[model samples]
Target: MPAALLKYALSRKYPARHAFTRRRDLKKRYDVVIIGAGGHGVAIAYYLSKYHGIKDIAILDKGYVGGGNTARNTAVIRSNYLTEEGVRFYRESVEMFQGLSNELGFNIMFENRGQLTLAHSDAAIRSFRWRAEVNQHMGVRSELVDRKTIAELVPNLNLSEDSRFPILAGLWHADGGTARHDAVAWGYASGACERGAELHQCTEVTGIETKCGRIAAVNTNRGRIECGIAVQAVAGMSSIVADMAGIRLPIHSFPLQAMVTQPYKPLLGPLVSSPHVHVYIQQTSRGEFVIGGGSDPYALYNTRSTLEMKETLSAAILELFPFLGQARVLRQWAGITDMTPDYSPIMGESPVEHYYLDAGWGTWGFKATPISGKTMAELIATGRTPDIIKPFELERFYRFQQINEAGATAASH
Candidate 1:
């Protein structure tokens, strides 16, 4: 063995650390108070410090950094959407992710292995056509592919007519792919800390106190913190956190579950999904088949996995790849999602003055982390919502102008 390995085997010695940040003591006040230290919060802090020159920020989380929804998600990244605004925003996000590793000085494990959304019915085929057209108009690399092309793309995939949902066509997206979820969070956290933003893990916000409508301070389990601006990015806990500031959001929380099969050789390549059957399958870098479906039947704020979802998701996966029946499932888990009626996130200023929102992420958040952070940072610095995020404003609900992405969002995230 090498000297490093021999030393480690004998006495568990390790090399010197590089640029890493640590949790620190909370202060009485900060220029900005960001709740939730997950990917979005950390990325927001990073962009604020790097781009806006606002470094006096604090990221407070009830749990350890990236231990929440950041790690729970499947880490799929794509920008093929139904709306022009959605496409533009997410395209910028995907572009940022393409160079994220170099910018953060951290390997985020971004695998650009493309994605395919299978269409099984006439309606699905038509929707795919419309979506592909829209995606193309917005400069997204998306198009409808027939069964013959899909077979050529993945030769081992099952396309037998005996299956209940026969393969008709697919929306092939060359830009869609996946990334390492935890690494993305850690990179953002490291960059933010290097820029002088503080991260306070295990620090939960208990209350949001206001004086005469403007921002005042936030009451946390550690201590009370006075801030001029308070931004909440608590994914599943959006409603509970916003209510503390007396602002109500149009969101319902539900548990979104997923599972992975035992490792095998690289059998799956691109991310595949069937909206008709509510199943999306992707092979991880470790050769495990990561499978997931729609949200749970009833809305609930829990992370507990269900056998019913497992069975349903498994059956759906088998319909597309019958050869996977022999592979055993290694693990299963769930993440809470704050779903919105329009299937779009609620960004920008809320009813409570000086309080910003990064809520209603639903299931498509991991893909939007960078863009959300960029826009949220710009919003915080300029006191105005960016044009890219204007369509997702909270007041849109009251104005009855919702950017609907239900058809594009329901089956997969």
Candidate 2:
């Protein structure tokens, strides 16, 4: 072993450092104040400080970093959407994710295992075909695969024609993958802090004070701090936080639940999903199966996991892999998703001047972290909405121009 490694191994007490700066007194002012210290919030701060040279940033979260939806999500990444705009936007994100670990100087454990969305009927096949075409047009590696191809891709899948929901075809996106969810957030937060951004955990924003239709200051539980620009990137609490800025968002909150089973020998490779049955499954690097489905039926702000959802998910996964019936569930969790009418994110400028909106992420927030951060940072630094994110502007809703990704997002998220 090298001298440094030998010395460290021989030392009785190992020196360990915190990933990011510890809590300190909140600054009286900041150049930019970001609400929510999740992946999106920290990524924006990271880009702003590292790329834009804006060092005075503060990321405040009610809880610790990555403890909210960032921790709850099952880190599936893809770009096979039905809309042209969605495909283009997420394509950049997927590309960014491919090089993220190197850019951030952190090991995010990203795996390009690909993803297969099983089709149960003719309707699903049609939608997948359309999505595949759109994705292909955008240079994304997506295509519709027949039953034979599906079986070849995931041999263990229950392909019995006599099953309740027999697989007909599949949407195969070779670029689809997964990563360590918390590590992504930690990487961004650490990078931003190293670049002079402050991450204030447990600092809850209480209210927003506007001066002449422009964001002036934010009142938090710790204290009041003025900011030149304010961006709200709180995932589940997007609406409530925006309301504090006196800007009402067209958002409805819903709880999305997921569970993981005890580790076993790896039996799955590609991530699998069935939109018709509203469930997706992927085995992690730790040999545990992560299973998730659509958001809860009704709108709510709670993150409590439901017994009914547990039953539903168990049944759904069993239909696809009956051999996993004996695998014990380790734990289950839920995260609140801010759903939009069009099933797409609401990004860019809001009604309040100097206040940006990164709301309406729903269940697809984790996948777009890198691109959203870069674009939102560019908008804040240049005062011009990047062309890539123009389609997601808040004004689109007023003009009845929603991007409409319901067919793409469904259980595939």
The number of the candidate with the highest TM-score is: 2
* Tens digit per residue, CA lDDT, model 2, 1-413: 79999899768797665678787999999999999999999999999999999999999999999999999999999999999999999999999999999999998999999999999999999999998998988999999999999989999999999999899999999999999999999999999999899999999999999999999999999999999999999999998999998888889999999999999888899999999889999999999999999999999888888999999999999999998899899999999999999888999999999999998999899999999999999999998999999999989988999999999999899
Q: Residue 66 of model 2: what lDDT?
A: 93
Each model's lDDT comes to 0.91, 0.94
Top candidate when judged by lDDT against the true structure: 2
**Candidate 2 Cα lDDT to native:** 0.94
TM-score of 1: 0.96
Clashes of 2: 0
Across residues 1-413, which tens digit of lDDT does each residue of candidate 1 receive? 79977777667356555343565678899999999999999999999999999999999999988888999999889989998888898899999999999999999999898889998899999998999999999999999999899998777778887789889899999999899999999999989999999998889999999999888999999999999999999898999999999988999999999999988999778899888889999999988999999999889987998899999998999899989989999999999999999999999998878899999999989999999999999999999899999999999988999888999887667
